[model samples]
Target: MCSDFEPLGKSSLFTILDACKASTRKSLQGINYFAAEAGEAFDGIRKMIEDKVALHNDSARLIENLKRARFYLKSDYKVHVARSSNIADHCCVYALSDPEKRDFAQDCDHEHNESCAECSNLTRTLNEIERLLEETEEDEELLHRTLKKFRSYREAIEAWKAHLLRSINQDLCRENLLDKLSNDEIYLNLDWAMKFLPIKSREPQSEFFGKRGI
Candidate 1:
């Protein structure tokens, strides 16, 4: 099975999480008897801790906003048919987000036979979903299962967004770029690109995803 962690492109939440863990661990390990008095000696460690907190808070806030927006990939979507109703509705795949928001599935088959690898993989995924439905004893259980899977999907989306935002922010960080924006608030907002970026900048960032679809 493919691993869920770090599945998206570079500089995603996994890096932030790893940095936070390492910083916390190093802080504990580097504790010194003179730390209370050794101000400069503790400065680097203190900055690391503060950086971790800022990164974590930024990532977490963006994730929460995305969950509220029902933002997710097309592949992460699914349709569940009820026993009483023949029609199935597609659902948004982000964890704890509204399930009613959905996109129709895109087809990829043409001349593939049943034995084809892609076809087989698709069949297995569908079968597993069916199995999960069969095992679900209550309506609440079904929703719980979907939310759990969607949480993973959300992380993947966040990772891709982070990667795209970093590319955009690289240019935005130049001193002249802030002058072009003409506002300190907008300049500061670029620090957390996805969450606080202005609409004019956000257009290109979103278009990045529109073209790549990842």
Candidate 2:
């Protein structure tokens, strides 16, 4: 599988694997992370593969092989994906500005600021859906499922955007409070870690099936 991907650059490999994962309703949180040019280079390849699979007598075998490839390759591929997604040299205007009002820029030289948006998951997911929609143009069931998954992600992002706006509003309120504070009186702020780990133990047999993480 690695040899098959060797001829394609890292970005094309990234797109193929991500597109497969997207079809499975996986979150495209880390993709094209180390790719020099993470453009849609392998789109034609995907279409060709889909066509061959359609015309092949053993279509199930081809699809099964693809499923296995995705499962096995992802663990190895994630290192590059994580690196590429996490490291954005530019001030990710994506992260610094309002999510709703953010503009996609070609060249941004501003100093990098930490932002969840810099991960570029949402952007990639949006693009993947467009491709998925095109690829599944003839398959109504697949199209419906793809749209369903997209709507779920869209709802989640919308909620996060609303939360971010409220946080900005709170920050403005805090600034006004700070302006009114006296020299003797100080405003105290408390920070807490809100991160959690997903832990599972002694799970039932039914838990092993359907929409599970690899």
Candidate 3:
């Protein structure tokens, strides 16, 4: 995600890139060991759910539970992104503490579990659907539907990450260009504007007023 800072010069670009690197590093590696563990703990639950769905494709109740779990898991990821700056705030303490024991996925092994943490805090689920065989999924259409949704979700996440990185790269390119500029040379950044209209002396009022159309 682009931060509030804008790069106006090489020095500014350096600072912006440094901050972006730090933010990405922290987000991926986590602020502390516990935070990273929370993410891994969530992945374990997701994998466990996938295993259950594979083993018991005929269980409709289990499928429904998986559906509900999907909703909770996706919502948890969104909340985590929104609250990335403050993980402990606006999140369930239980989910934050010893997240390995939060087996919401296993809870769905039999039936839909209605109870969740007060804030419904869970970890961000990653893409690990490679183990699923197409033939097995074909046997259960509902299972395929659930997995498709997860696949789409993961694709969207990857796309966003790509876009953020692309934007950072563009800024870095601009910085490089500026760095090569000679002392006498100047850089002009042109931004999009409304259509240009040629001004004429004593133009008609109607023509002058309607000359520009965006």
Candidate 4:
């Protein structure tokens, strides 16, 4: 959950980060239109929206690549297993044709078909791919859980930002007490800093900060 977990490399890990950033930025930009003043704040929000759109598009491409990788791995697994089964079946047929020759044929066929170095290597490859797939799946689950927590954090941030902006706008228009306006910006900045800083930390601490912000 390290903000350093910022999307990197060609892996699905990057995809998750891109998606999270995209969602967070888009939400912030949407909220900003209703929450912030014109000029700097509005321009900043517009830039965020543009950046988030790009990230979102990149995430989509990454997801498609992941799907293709998964499909290839699955197809390879199926083909390897099918080939193994067919070879085993052929060995069984040869062994059954002659009772006297059964032992030799079984031993020879098992070594030739099932225990060949090439077959062993292919089996190892399949096992490794399966393990990688499982790890990728687990990573994806963790990413989703992290994203859910992030969404909640974002919602709270938006609400707090909007409330502060409204208070400031009201004060500027002479609708709120000046004394109240005096503390609003300070308290809002404090709240935002508290929420933003710790999210940049590593997991567990990051999650703790996110929940606390909520």
The candidate that wins on TM-score is 3
lDDT of predicted model 2: 0.43
List of clashing residue pairs for candidate 1: none
User: lDDT for every model?
Assistant: 0.34, 0.43, 0.43, 0.38
Q: TM-score of predicted model 2?
A: 0.30
Identify the superior model by TM-score, candidate 1 or candidate 4: 4
lDDT top scorer: 3
Query: Clashing pairs in model 3?
Result: none
Model 1 misplaced stretches (Cα beyond 4 Å): 1-138, 174-214
The runs of at least 3 residues in candidate 3 whose Cα sits more than 4 Å from the true structure, single-residue gaps closed, are 1-125, 128-139, 193-214
Candidate 2 has its poorest 10 consecutive residues by lDDT at: 32-41
Q: Quick one: ranking by lDDT, best first?
A: 3, 2, 4, 1
lDDT of 3 by residue, 1-214 (tens): 5898764999888988888785431122211333233333434445545566464553454334445544544355344422112333222222224546654312211322343342232222142232443435665776676567555544543443333333444665688899999999998999854453455322223344444543
Clashes of each: 0, 3, 0, 0
Per-candidate TM-scores read: 0.19, 0.30, 0.31, 0.19
For residues 1-214, could you state the per-residue lDDT of candidate 4 as single tens digits? 7766765567787888778775432223222332323223223322333344333544444334434433433244223322113344223333234557654433333343444333344334334433433444446775465345434433443343334433444444453344566643643322242323333212322234335434
Quote the lDDT for 88 in model 1.
17
Residue 153 Cα positional deviation in candidate 3, in Å, after optimal superposition: 1.2
